[model samples]
Target: MSIHLFQISLTQLQGVGPQKAEELHALGISTVGDLIEYYPFRYEDYRVREMHEIKDGERITIQGTIASLPTMQRFGGKTRLICRVTVESMLVTAVWFNRAFLKEQLTPGREITLTGKWEQRRRQMTVADSEFPDKGGAKTGTLQPVYSVGGSLTQASIRKMINQALIQFGALIPEILPAELLEKHALLPRRSAITRIHRPENTLEGQEARRRMVYEELFLFQLKLQAYRATHMKQADGLVHPVNNEEIRQFVSRLPFELTGSQKQVINEILHDMKQPYVMNRLLQGDVGSGKTVVAAVGLYATVKAGHQGALMVPTEILAEQHTRSLGAMFEPYGIQVGLLTGSLTERKRRDLIASLQMGLLDIVVGTHALIQEDVYFRSLGLVITDEQHRFGVNQRSILRRKGMNPDVLTMTATPIPRTLAITVFGDMDVSTLRERPKGRKPIKTYSVKHNMMDRVLGFIRKEAEQGRQTFFICPLIEESEKLDVQNAIDLHMQLTHALPELAIGLLHGRMNAAEKEATMATYAAGETNVLVSTTVIEVGVDVPNATLMIVMDADRFGLSQLHQLRGRVGRGEHQSFCILIADPKSENGQERMKAMTDTDDGFEISRRDLEIRGPGEFFGTKQSGMPEFRLANLVNDFEVLEQARDDAAALTASESFWSSQSYKELRDNLNRDAKQQTEPLD
Candidate 1:
């Protein structure tokens, strides 16, 4: 019978009551379809093996007959059950801790199988799981799926419920991938994949099932992105602006510094997109000091020269103000009116800025989220640029784009994203990368030290301050947290003030209001504060050329990309800058992160390692970074599969007949449904 598994309630399954249903819902399994798709994170190999064949320290499953009655021993707050089992004619001691109930089944001459780690010295086995041959739920000689359970649900219970759901509704599972696509990729049918993934007879079968799921996930994601691009191009209301090449060239020539080759090429790409019949959707990626701002200014200048307006949205007010000052000075000679609109603006100032934008009096407006306010309107907003694109959600990007008539959008990020993520997360937009740093920028020297070196680090900072340089002391937390052992900005600032009272110290964090943060940053930027103790709030877009020192406390608490970003805050000028990571991390991952910081100053390399260590989920807050959470696909390890899937998705989206054909109706419907469910950006 035909059915929609998604519409069937998980509570309808046997033994799943309201409480259990609520628990499952918390795990993102509310419907029967979600339950079936809830694949296991790993599996247990319980295939029976002979004791003599098993290697020392190897975890193996052995079938045997009970050779002796079980004996129980009580200890301090713990109990142990010991029994002798004859495995392949050899007697081995099986031990189970705190499992007193197992004694009832460990009778003499009873046949059973035990899976555990074997110690050859004592010929003893630490039984992790045991099952009798006559048991109903025996998982012997198979790969048992292990799921990630939460609340009161055990792995056994989850597995049981999944089995029940599959047995009852397996026939209703529809194939999401088209038949031709599946055959081309050699993917299993959806129903078979679901079944084998949950209960595979062997490791190879399980891997094949996992491969199918990974490809399906990546393909579906790419399809949505491609479809979004297609829909936008089809409804293209883009304006074809006349290119004033001479004027733009003159503006570029007027700059004090010469443009690099990469910058010039990227500018050509942006300018070319502007002249196209379709709206330009581009992502500009650059390292922290790679001169992305200059390239963005050129794009904005092109829009203004065409008698249109532009708006740049940043994550923080301080960055917006910094951009306003720098861009305003650069455009002053060119007669371009640039305005700043932030939440900290006074009422009269905000009103006047809004009026100027609406009247086309402002050529380029740089602001925070305040630019997307309801009262703000632009007369001819032709270009929209967002700095630190990962900071904003997809919906926020769409909202800002909606402010204009299908404006050519340019999103910029200083965070060096790996090539794999760049293609998948932003498959909808064209990409422009600037790898070459601006001329004459020095590499920042980095070091990792323990907490005991704080005194020496402080002495070095004092010397730097004496040499007429600034320093930034970054903490992970704004306020003191009892649960965490890391340094807090407030306490660090206080201690530093006492330790180095001679140097002027200032505090900055996210807890402060926008106005206060702006004021604090202004003082630090203007050299009034020689030492600024702040949190990660100053992680991005806070450019201080004279600041030659960066000290990060508890650096292990941060990801590699973040540590790199913090390090990038310095090394902006020609001076020999330094970044000291103060962390005594115990975990191997943390140690690797610290070592990575001291090894290289390359942002791209650090980001690649970050993806490998933290995976894609924590690459940059997956929810906010616009990265989809795939069940079986890994952006780092499964790059090849992802590439193939992307190619197939591109081919499928380019076919107009495929979308309209009756054979592909189900796939089209699924695509539309997925699109409606997500809050994806239009541009």
Candidate 2:
């Protein structure tokens, strides 16, 4: 049961020194266990066949002896190594290009095996691989694993390393999965799966082996997540807030706009969770301009009505100020006091705000991560809400939740999470989605155009500005990067100021201090600036109703999800909005992303395509979002396996037998070990 052997470094291997070990580590193989799990991306079948049975353009292996001495010939800087081999009583020419080193090995009457593409008409084989059979070459007519090797590594060298690992340590791999679970799924044992995956005799064996490994990875991952959910539920007792429907209805009636059906449904779900005995851990998903804030306001209102406080956390100070204004306007009718806290606030003002929160003088408070400061505390923190939830780390969310003893937590995001991630990354929390935008919202018209049409687009912008409408000019960077050819916000702002000298322009980017960002955004929001040139900082919470046009420079530089978010910024107003994407994408994938943006305005569809194109890691901005990088199991292609694993993990985690039985000891140990390594919260 000792894992000491598996924990040994790859440097212990015969030919692996520090440099070679570092290369293996780059492939996620630092230990023997890692080496065994480093499965090949593909396999080649080199079945020895008779020369008569070979067909044109087919890759075949033929065994023969050298009939004539190998000769090197040069023709106009192109070198060829040619030899005639005797195969099945016939002489067939074996050809290799730029392989002068093979001449020393191909001696007359020497026995060798050649594998290459065969051309029936030429009576020749273009040798792709050759082996000296009597000198411990691999057996003919067997499957060979083709690993994805890089940087001073070759296929044969990797094959050799894997073989050495299997021979020395494959059997020592502990079977941590419970026997019952393995039998129920008909999975191969850990040892056999590793061996078959690396050295399968046939395709079916390889596939089955892969299936076992994929399931094992997913099962272990889900076990940790589900265990966290179950353990937390058992340990924490949540506040039960009173739901006053008549009061909520009266508040909704006084609103300026009618709530969409999606909004009302989500409000009901959140309110329903609030009144429950346990704490609310729910995710609110809606596209940009889906009115999630109003629904969230109702929840805060309900909490305040129950004589408890509410807090909303956002990623940016500008968003906090915006939410405070909007929510303050809504809550004023009912005499609910809302306060704002931010890093930019003076020390005296911040102290006063903290004192107000501690004294229970404020009904609701909105702030940036400044809300999670060690000194910040709430007297009766009943419900916790986070806007742009993906921007905050799990630890930050957890810290905010800890401010209240089992407060109902409601997190909101404008980024539409794909279904695969909804089940994996957020499987532990209850989810409410707002698919329909509020009524009277028009679809944003999107276009992908080349740089040559910039003059025409600029003229259109001028006409729009003349009509008293505003524009948002988006750039990928704050300053022009030497490696990237995209326009920058500072230079763009200057250019627009000169070219359209009649219009007022304002620039905003991350490099600006918090007060500067707020002031610049304030000027644009108040109609003092006709164009706001900025980066993605405005992608989330800046809601300008009059801005009707969005011009994104070098649109191909952004991901599909990001492009969708940026597009969401302009279409908030009733005026017919247009999103102009300017770029000349060089890669096919880049071109496809641009095309997908122009084709549809649906956030969910865009997210699905984004998940497929850029994958889960980049889809969620994995580094900041804490999305796990899986090695074998793909959330998109292996969705069925993921679901099965999730269901099984949940069932097992919820079962009393799993907790009480000794048969599950090893599995329990694995779950505990994984829990120790996990820094992200279950939500």
Candidate 3:
């Protein structure tokens, strides 16, 4: 009759049969600990309304009586009920479609309270999701928790299960934070917080509980990051590539374009890190097309010149191939050999390449995750760089790092996170940013348009194609999805082909295999495909300089950084590139994203706006190497708490007793587990 804490499965709980357990498991709540962590995404305040306060477009509660029986009729195979409810003195029409069953509840002189949205234009109110209470039964104000449900799950069911858990195991949940720390921050105890989160008595209590949960989440995250840094710093000496080598200087001098000051400054920082004895674990952050690849190439060349090998791991095969082709061309005159390893290589050719790498015949190598295969080996690898590293998982980077003995690690990201967010997210690594685009790269012209201007946009793309340029149409989905109402790549491609039959259009998405994607991209890059229709899968490693127009459908569905990346795909080419957003977003946040994209082409500014609107958990999602969904914390509102947690972690970790204390054994174990569970991407 005892609960085993985090290990106890949800199936063991009362009334939780196999079907119920499966539903919970789908939501990542297989165990008691996960259930405790599955906080509600939102809460509804059930405020009882005064009848006089009814207004158009407002959600209000009305205490009323059914003036007469509602009229039920069938219209086009659907039943509808119409009634006039008397609220105090005003009688307003209430309608329900396909709910003739509710006609029984609208008996004459029946008294009730109804809550729903009032639409003035429709001249009626709907009761689809409204809550009702018996009239004169003394309605009570309350708050209800609404969870993210799917499949067979429902919000009411989840709330019921959580309340059951609170009754059974709430008090037994252990507290990990020190008493002094809790008192200093005015945080509620762990047990009290969990109970209040599930079943709070009032609004104020719920806020206090949520605040405590946010603080704990932030504190644990910072504590683990500090531990990871401490662990990494204790590693053995790393290989050094002496800075200011003649080969490096000569390579930079030979490039076609001059390096911007920001690029130069970042190169200095990276070179300085490489020359140091300790492992150079640095993050290179730049906006899309800010010359990050060139800097990475220079670092790789420096390591090769020092008589060591270099490896660049990218996320996709197309990107890997592009880097290999470009870097091979750039390094050929310098006598440094560049190699490629990918899933698409034939067996014999791949084996020969592996042998050459093992024998140190190749000076530099570019590859997808294939480089992390067991057979791949490097001869004295000194530097490891991951391109668009956000596309990679933390373990993938660590595995590549293990290929070389304490190699200097440099991770690059094109997402321009604010400096403050960067500190909290990548606190374990030194950060260098490239804030400038290379000279001669024209700023992209962005325009936001509604769906009504579709024909005009199509004509614009046709015009660009007539000039021997290309265009990209980005959709949010690879195929039609039941849940998502946005356009899909397949549907868009078909529609575009019908609209412009003369132009050669191509289709690309993430679901396409390595060979298929490569072929599709090849045709597009060769200008044979005048218009390429794709999903956001083309977000990374797609370079078509001749492609001048990027039209994103459902543009509001994408984050600002993501939209910027898609916009970047077009502006890479000269000829006054343009990005057209086809959108009419329904939500305020979506409208904000659309406005931000049209306001400026600056990635950093867009990123700041993205973080503010979407929050950090989503800002760093799966496509961009996000951490776990934070249940409580706001990266913007709680930035001060983040700073405090970071300071506390650093100060506590520096203390001798921090690791040795017996009281922190559970906490230490949790930190290690969290570090392994989350992917740490460079911002």
Candidate 4:
């Protein structure tokens, strides 16, 4: 009756052999409870209609008498069973391809209810799979649940399995949701919901059952997130040194350029949170070229000025080196020392950097995951900033926190997330977004070109390279994949070399070692490489101001946010930047992305469209992005339910007596499991 019962093996069930059980397990259904909860994707109506009333091309069920004898015929390498049935007075021709066995079941004067698409022009139907109804059965007006099946399982096989389950284990079903909560939400009883979700007696029963399942999934998820938020907020921030307006003014004025209004507003938010008693768990989201680095430096500078150290962790060594150089230029003038520690650094150099940081001589350290190993120590660490935060897992971020006592964490993500997702996923942290681009920055012109236009695009790239500007040729794969039609970096590099032999070409991918990638990036950065062919490895970093053109091959293969990130690689300089997307995708989603990329340069708007097109799971790489997958609840369609559930969870968690209540024991256990199952920094 508890959660463990849900894990009972399907092999123990009747009519299930080892092979069938293995096949079922492949679909994530290895237990009796999982089978019961496997709700239908849609319903097929067996409600027989008049033959004359069946519309053309509509899947219909029609009842008729066998007025004519069934005949067998041979077609092009296939068998066909032909028959004529009289429905009232009209004759309908039914053709079942490769189903000569149906002739034995279709005897003269035998009445049958058939389901297939109607072809009114020829008065015939190519019948789909059909089965005979039971004696005294009247299923012509009922709905039959049609589940999504795979791995040698048919609808009938699932039905037989469920029928056996309902007979054997139906009486033992225990309610997971508390009775009071069920009453408040007007949800169906647990057993009835399970029964109707699989084999509903009518349309209304199925609808009610589905609603309850969705509500249960969403409510539990919300509860887990709320608990995490409460626990996170309880952790006290050890560093609360206040840097007032004068210090902030000095820091901002120290820069060569002026700060944007949005950037100033976000800094105020970060600074206020840092000065609070609790740690500042904040995600600083901004569009590309929106001056996030300056604001982050300001935050770190304030922490360092307060006589504490800081560490800025990035995903790539190239980006970390870039950050070290940029931060050093700004901090050097303020008498603050910045250290660059990466995997590529020599052992002696790394040890020296670590000793300097441990001795309090280094004001801030910028590096990759190399900053979090056992030997790397920081003295009085107050702030930790992670660039391209999503690239690192939640555990990776929290590991840095342990180096210092609840250091204020600031995670920077250039992907502009929609508001709904920010509230749901980042519920544990306060968010500050940089919305406006820096002054004098130009928007990159975008184009969605077909494969045939590559000649013109190649010509343009050559022209740009000849003008002393660089171009990036981005492919989705590192090597050519037979399964994926997208161009690969290795082949594209060769192709570009042959096409533009006068200019130098380079290759970059994630598979390359740190030193190899760094050297390749260095050559491209130094203007020695005119054309850089790479994968999404250069999505976040590899900021080359001279790189003004971006040509993405098979652009339709990427997510919208990824495409936008690739586009951000360019347009970092004063020259007019352009993005050429070469793709001819077959799906509607592909077409939508192509149009979105070519239409405008608004990251926020593009993300909103992306979220609408591909729900939360795909938008954020569900598991990898530190988000849980829902079995029933949809983030887009059930946004209101999600909000309501969050409110309910907050109230439930805050209630003093609810924790000790006997009725909520199962829920408490589930919450604990959910917590341990998915631990995230800003979940």
TM-score leader? 1
Model 2 pairs whose backbones collide: none
Candidate 3, residue 129: Cα displacement in angstroms equals: 12
TM-score of 1: 0.86
What is the per-residue lDDT of model 4 for residues 218-306, given as tens digits with 9 covering 90 to 100? 77776776777676675674578688779889879878989999999999999988888887888999998898999999999999888
RMSD of 4: 4.5
Could you arrange the candidates by lDDT from highest to lowest?
1, 2, 4, 3
- Give the clash total for candidate 2: 0
TM-score for each predicted model, relative to the true structure? 0.86, 0.85, 0.68, 0.83
- Tens-digit lDDT string for candidate 1 (1-683): 02488889988888889999999999989888889989999999899986658998998999999999999999998999999999887899999999998899888999989999999989999999898997753788888889999999999899999999999989898887888888998999888988999999898889999999888888888887777777765454786667799998999999999999999999999999998879898999998899999999999999998889999999988889899999999999989999999888899999998999999888899988888888899999899999998888777888888888888889999998898888887888888999998999988999999899999999999999999999999999988788998889999999999999999999999989987887898899899999999999999989999999999999889889888889999999889999999987676788999988899888888899988888877887855545677778888988888888878888888898767888877768777665422535434
Clashing pairs in 4: 47-140
Alpha carbon deviation, residue 514, candidate 3 (Å): 11
Kindly report which residue stretches of model 1 are placed more than 4 angstroms away from their true locations once superposed. Answer: 1-35, 50-58, 64-79, 85-91, 97-112, 131-138, 148-172, 343-352, 393-399, 476-498, 501-529, 556-560, 584-592, 608-627, 673-679
Q: Whose lDDT is greatest here?
A: 1
TM-score of 4: 0.83
Q: Of the candidates numbered 1 and 3, which has the greater TM-score value? A: 1
lDDT, residue 561, model 4? 88
| Candidate 3 lDDT over residue span 302-398, tens digit each | 8987888999998888888899988998888878899889988999999999999999998898999999999999888899998887778777788
